[model samples]
Target: MSKLPLDPDVADVAPTDSALTPYDNQHIVTYARLLQAESEGADWREVARIVLHIDPDHEPDRAQNAYLSHLARAKWVTGQGRLLRGAGSN
Candidate 1:
């Protein structure tokens, strides 16, 4: 079986908070999923469990916060952060 890219040990598989930080190339797919979920109005708890592997049942606050933080970072990347990374010119 092929390994999934969602390994927690792999740093760039998730979004970071810094607007100055270059977007992690590896998180492209993850960002797509987050955007899709946002568009579809999916619940953050479910997204946290499924996409981010965070169990809201076990750690509700942490899961909710992680989901919101990552989603916000994803949105930033697709918006202003993209400009910072020169996404359109490519």
Candidate 2:
């Protein structure tokens, strides 16, 4: 793996695919944060702003869509790939 930005710019819409996309590789850290926030039961709105850098208050649809899509991808990756999963998940 190449050097990944810990804080990459998020897209308003994430690529939808069963297979991982280049965006997914670049945003692994973002996925980790999203998963962490989800595990903590953090508000989606708060996670959108803090982790995704999207202000939900300003753009409800965009924020929600991005948040949901990215989070789904994060979970999918955790299931499909071992990169983000904790050792215990195995």
- Residues 29-50 of candidate 2 have per-residue lDDT tens digits of 8989999999999999999999
Angstrom error at residue 44, model 1: 1.0
lDDT of 1 by residue, 10-85 (tens): 2323456554353444454566677889999998888878887878899887887777776777777777656346
Candidate 1 error regions (>4 Å):
1-23, 81-90
| Model 1 C-alpha RMSD to native | 5.4
**The 10-residue segment with the lowest total lDDT in model 1:** 4-13
Q: In model 2, where is the ten-residue run with the lowest total lDDT? A: 81-90
Per-residue error for 6 in candidate 2, Å, reads 0.3
Error of 1 at 34 (Å): 0.9
lDDT of each: 0.64, 0.84
